[model samples]
Target chain A: MARIYNFSAGPSMLPEPVLQQAQQEMLDWRGSGMSVMEMSHRGPHFMAIAEQMKNDLIELLAVPANYRVLFLQAGASAQFAMIPQNILNGKTKACYVNTGAWSTAAIKEAGKYCEVQVAASGESTAFTTIPAYADWRVDPAAAYLHYTSNETIHGVEFNDIPDAGDLPLVCDMSSNILSRRVDIGHYGLIYAGAQKNMGPSGVTVVIVRDDLVGLEAKNTPAVFSYAQQAKADSMLNTPATYNWYLLGLTLQWLKGEGGVVAIEQRNIRKANKLYQAIDDSSLYRNPVDPACRSRMNVPFVLADATLDKAFLEQAEQQGLSTLAGHRSVGGMRASIYNAMPEAGVEALIEFMAEFERTH
Target chain B: MARIYNFSAGPSMLPEPVLQQAQQEMLDWRGSGMSVMEMSHRGPHFMAIAEQMKNDLIELLAVPANYRVLFLQAGASAQFAMIPQNILNGKTKACYVNTGAWSTAAIKEAGKYCEVQVAASGESTAFTTIPAYADWRVDPAAAYLHYTSNETIHGVEFNDIPDAGDLPLVCDMSSNILSRRVDIGHYGLIYAGAQKNMGPSGVTVVIVRDDLVGLEAKNTPAVFSYAQQAKADSMLNTPATYNWYLLGLTLQWLKGEGGVVAIEQRNIRKANKLYQAIDDSSLYRNPVDPACRSRMNVPFVLADATLDKAFLEQAEQQGLSTLAGHRSVGGMRASIYNAMPEAGVEALIEFMAEFERTH
Candidate 1:
């Protein structure tokens, strides 16, 4: 089966092996005489899959023993309200670093339940760079300091982990998670949308320090309450069983490919090659500063915007599909996630060069 | 490929055709050279699927022009909170009819946001029957009157839509939806977890009257807010895309089988045969009142309680799997959803008869 190099931001490309294995097992998962989608969540079979997926995530992230890994349904967008509702504890205030669309969204949602202090912002820079750490107005008495590790729309990333002092650091690592290695112990809570680096769009993987598991704010829905979900093993409701099992396959694939550290190195090489190619080209340009440009989602605009449609159509014909940028930030975004092979990136670079010459 | 009849309560059986279709498209969906899992939710390919799904549902349910259909993520448990947060509007109190576990859960979550008035409850009957409309004590001043149409665990169903007078009737049709025909116009809102008779978990279909769309209580997260979801065409977030696509397949299969009216007839026959078999047996009996017994989930207890383990084991061996009842209410539950062929029901009856006679 010939496949295209998908760069559609998310619900984007998945590991081909994962998809093939899932197809093979779609009719009957592991000789259970039923698809994973057909199993009862409380059944022993589903329980095993759930346990294995959780453990793999723990090992891949090298999650501390004090941290709890949860596979919650819905995307990180749900976490916007859930975070303040769960982690605020007794504090009526929280600090947010507005990096781009994702962080700004969180700040807006948090404003509903608490006093949100804009600790730092890259809005002044047109989201081309991250706000310097020292410029952040840290609220020492706040419940937590939140930021987006990677701004998907703006193509801005924070390579350096900002210190929140004694306060817990909550990070929305949606677009860039599992693409590189990071210290899991540094964050009180970390959430990544599965559609990006993980699996599909059905689940969100949340890794939260055990201390953040309890102490929920009042009137919080049980489904959104971190304490409740952790206690229930993230099975407070029937999960997206098909999505969860498929995620397990991806995690297994990640392990087979020599774990996260090995993948991170490959990712760095791919990102550098694509960025260098774009930098050398007069017909294409990436707006973000080199130091903090996202490795996962690289948004580059054509020198002439009129060529956007032709470029996308030609890319599609070349089996390079879904290269459209997000409407919020009009340009072309190639979300070369972990599933994207380095060959795909090389192909993209070559195609860009050819297209640039013709244009 | 040989398939077994899966009797799981939810995350239950899907039409084999849907599974086969999904498997065929896993590698390359309609020559798009990408799996549905890899499709962009906002792109034409996925948007077409999403659009088809919404239209199919509208046609099948005979949804009124005044009602809006929304596909949202995270299962119906999330809706337990969302419903109260959105529908309570300006009212501080809402009336709820408690028939079983699902209703109880909804009540608990609703209490977090508003005063839940238990208009009627069948807990006194051990949740074996739906409270009669005459016995209801609904508050006339309530924002809406809510009830669970089918109790998954209790094996009780309201065969008739309860009279709520001028008040908007809200129904949680998780188990029984689309298995039977109901007047969509009667409900202000109808939410069902797409697991049982629908498709899979992760996506919850919410059908609400258009007039009820904008009245969200303060601090309602956009993901849960009906107005926001409606405005965004249910793309408030990425949504459970794979789950949504699979649901569309199930809806198509339903149409192929002649829509909800035809399925309701088949469900009625299936339920009758199983109930009759139990009623005729000396060693088995269904606890629910015959009038209120669920057509989808039929729970029965063996006369010899100690034989439960042996019954389950032998049934599994014979390929009648997952007939074990919910943990909350133990025994045997044969959730013969729409996908379960009449032949499977005959096989189950034969197995039950044989098992009972052997003991």
Candidate 2:
């Protein structure tokens, strides 16, 4: 069976190899006589899988020795509350840069625990661009400065880390994590929901600097406490064992495919090809500023809005799927995460051109 | 490949049929051209799977119309905090029945959010027996009376729901949910981590009565708020797509196995046969009171403690694996959840008899 190019923003595609490996081992993982799903998290087999997953992620990202890596659950949405809970310490206020839907979500959850101050926002531009860092009114006294590295909905990406100086820099990299090389040292904390580039939709990864670990707001749920999870080696309770192992397989695949550096180059090429095709087209338009457009999620509108339905219906008939935009907004979105090959991007471009010529 | 009689508690085992079905659908789900892992949670396919899963669970549990079903993440551990966060509405205190490890955890997390009153505890008897509800110091003024339906670590099960007349009855049925039929109308809320008696680890199920749904405490994380989750149909974030689909398969398998009533009969036979074997043995002992013994996780100690390692090793050689008891209190634990067939339990009994005779 031919697999279609899956472009869903998240719960997106995993490498075919990863899915195959998981399928082959669905009943017995490495002859353990039990499915990975049935293995105890504290058992040696799962523990090894968990350890290897952490080590590989650390190696891939070159995470500093002082950072604590945790495989958590709930998702990045939980991190919206957890980051402020764990990082706010004694500070009653935090600074945020709002770029799009996700950044807005972070601000909303952060408001639950502390005074969230938006240092800058792109709402004035309908989330079409990120405000220049020079224009950001960052507060040095705030607990930390938070930003979403890539806004999945608006298709805005931060090309460079925004400077937070003395305040810790926290980022929501859910849509773009591991798609590119990152300097882990620049952020006090980093988190991503594993549905996108990581693996599937169960495990959530959090990388928190050591010094930023212990402090938690009163009444922080134990599941949301980095210090508690770190102390327990993230086995604060039963983990999503199967998802963890699937993620491990994805990490292994990523490494076998030449690690994050090679993946980043491929991601750049795929994004460039798609963006170039859109820019050259008379029938399609992307509203986000080119300088800050996401290399992960590309939202574009058909020149004739009336043709949108027919375009999507035909795309599916031709084995391209999930290219529809997030329902909150109206245009079409193509999310080419790490697992999406440049060939998929090329196919999408070819489809666009053919559909336009025929019209 | 021949499968083993896996006895690991929690993340323990799944029905052979469920595993086989999942393997068959691992790459492409029903000609969808993508793994369920790659599907968007909001898409029609996954939405149907989610709806079917909920219906099966409701039919199997006889869930009342006034109750709401939610698929959540993190785990039962997250519910330890969330239960109080959502249930403690205007009430300054809550009642708890502490039976074992999970019960103790619930009390601890609840303490973080409210004034917890231990109505009854098994600590006086080393958690080997459930205290009678008549002996409980239950407070009618408390918002809720919470308990673990089965103490997984202690091999104790509350044979009857504890009486909590005016107060809401909240239960954590993580290890035993769906193993037996439950009267949903009796419970204000019931939660289970879906690793045992359901499908795999990752997704959690919460069944909450309508009137008890909306009262989230201030600062409750949106991800932890059942009202918000129930409102959004639990897509407040990406639901654990693959795990969610796997659970759907398990529910389908459960229904095909004649639903919970039939499974409960099988479970009863399996538990009785094993318990009788242990009770009849000169070289084994089970500490939990027979009146409230668990039908799911049966913890036993060898008459000769020195032979524990030999037993586990030989059991592995015999394709009887993970029989070692929980480390906190160890000798042997044979978790015979619904997935554990009666034949497997008989095999364990035969193994116990043969080993006793040989030693």
Candidate 3:
């Protein structure tokens, strides 16, 4: 069978070119006589690969000189604990915005280390809309303010970076990091699991401003300390060598596709088409607010829940795989990240239309 | 260049058959129309992969029904902290045996969460020999006994398990797991990083006894909490999905080559041949105690210190790669894990003889 458009929320579709390049280099990487997985993390060959990957990511994101880009493990979930551990800096409280599942999770974890102040919440609106920034009650004395840039499950995203006053702004960009342009200078920290927009699972990218590098709480694991990891260039321990190489390949592929800016344009066009199709149809309706619906994960529900099984079965047959929405919000979700070609989205749209016409 | 014998301490060589299978399935996994990297970790396809991999490991290790095997991230370094955090069980002190570099590192991390009691030390012997078992000062009140079964950097290993009496025994088997048979019933927890004997760098295998599952310290990260992760089947977060698949493939290959009991015999032969060659050569020597020398990583030095660079260069030219010893130790090290074939070791021995004859 030909490669299908995988709509998995994470560990999702990667660029076909990246996969091809990986397969080509599986036995021996670039004449080095060893797979990337076999190279010593500290050896010359792997060091070169690691350096190029970090530099490419910094270049693609236009990250500020004052910030350090770290490739880590344990995903964005680890950062939920690490953010407060490293950046809380002796403060007794942290402010968090509860936009959806991801934010709520972060807030819960932060509560373990410090007093959590829920600055604002979208739960009142069933997580379908981002709470108005003007209405948020952020505590200025808090150590930092954290929020999830894109709520992957609820399909809500913030259109603009929210100001956190004097407190450092932290963002979890797991579902939408490279899909759009953002000034890295706006946040004190930004982290995303590579499984989504980057490459595969295992590696997490953390971009932190220089000032947030130190100040870990006592008893913090060395591997999770941003200060220690950044000092070692994220090689404080044996890293995920093969995953790093795959991530580098993906970034190189992105550059060939004209970097983040160009890719963002494509993402916006693709997202608009899918959302337009959803809005244009009566049978399918997206519950998320029009202004804040996630461009990476577009979730919708059919008017009649009875057709859900048939809709998914037919979509799978059409090679539009994993269209089911999150179990918490049962319907259908089409996660079209940067690697998800526009043709894949079009294919999903056509299938949805045909299904609606028949049912 | 052809695939050479990689002898890096970690992130070492993998079976060619595993790499070949991965390459063959890179674009589409068994007609799933998606790469394994593209599958949802929760979807049926990935769930099947995950199950098979876990079951294979359990079968290969003969893991007792009372043990839970977890596929985790952040490598074994994270386990250093997690072990104490999860199993301290309100005890203030834990006993640790210091054999070499890995044990020293584990002790350092474990100290952050509990009062570390040195049960025995090989440091007095320059980490070349394990201390006498009868001389160990085991504290009955301690929460657990921690020891590194094999040290990659120091080329040392424990010939037999140390009796901790009634205390839960924890072993860091990262560099030598699956190369030998062991009774899982004897351990409270056994953790190994996948880069060496298992598969890749992103995944760490943790086999923990049921009695040691809960009892996490306050504020422990959910992802690192053994009890919570066990309940979630190690899906507490998005795992390193592709890494797990690779590990599964490696395990399957191992099963085909004969399980741990069979691999142990081969490993013994490989290590013995390499050691015999070094002992026979007047130009080369290994400093480790013969009784407890590692079967995985064998660190040796040339009689003439000046020949180090030439030895590495000429070895590389002969397609023998990454033979350089760890930087901390400064010599030559050959890590012949389970995946390393007898032919590769024979090639190395032949090269060693030729190099000795010339220089």
TM-score of each: 0.99, 0.99, 0.99
Candidate 1 lDDT by residue in tens digits, B1-359: 36788888988888899999999999999988899999999989999999999999999999989988999887889888898889887889999999999999999999988898999999999998877788899888999999999998999998888889888999999999999989998899999999998898888999999989899977888688999999998988898899989999999999999999999999999999999999999989999998899998999999999999999999988888899988888999999999999988999999999988899
Could you give candidate 3's per-residue lDDT for residues B39-120 as a string of tens digits? 9999999999999999999999999999999999998999999999999999999999999988999999998998999999
lDDT of 3 by residue, A200-279 (tens): 99999999999999889989999999989998999989999999999999999999999998999999999999999999
Error of 3 at A163 (Å): 1.2
Worst 10 residues of 2 chain A by lDDT: A1-10
Report residue B99 deviation for candidate 1 (angstroms). 1.1
Q: What's the lDDT of the predicted structure labeled candidate 2?
A: 0.90
Indicate the residue-level lDDT of A228 in model 3. Answer: 90
RMSD of 3: 0.7
Question: Which candidate, 1 or 3, has the higher TM-score?
Answer: 3
**Ranking, DockQ, top scorer first:** 3, 2, 1
Q: Tens digit of lDDT per residue, candidate 2, span B1-359?
A: 47788888979888888888888888888889888888988888789888988888888888889999999999999999898889888789999999999999899999988899999999999998888777999889999999999988898997777779889999999988988877878888999999888888998999999998889987889988988999999998888988888888888988999999899999999999999998998999999989989999999999889999999999989889888888889889999988887888989889889999999
Worst 10 residues of 1 chain A by lDDT: A210-219
For this target, which candidate reaches the highest lDDT against the unseen true structure? 3
Residue A179 alpha-carbon offset, candidate 1, angstroms: 0.7
DockQ of 2: 0.79
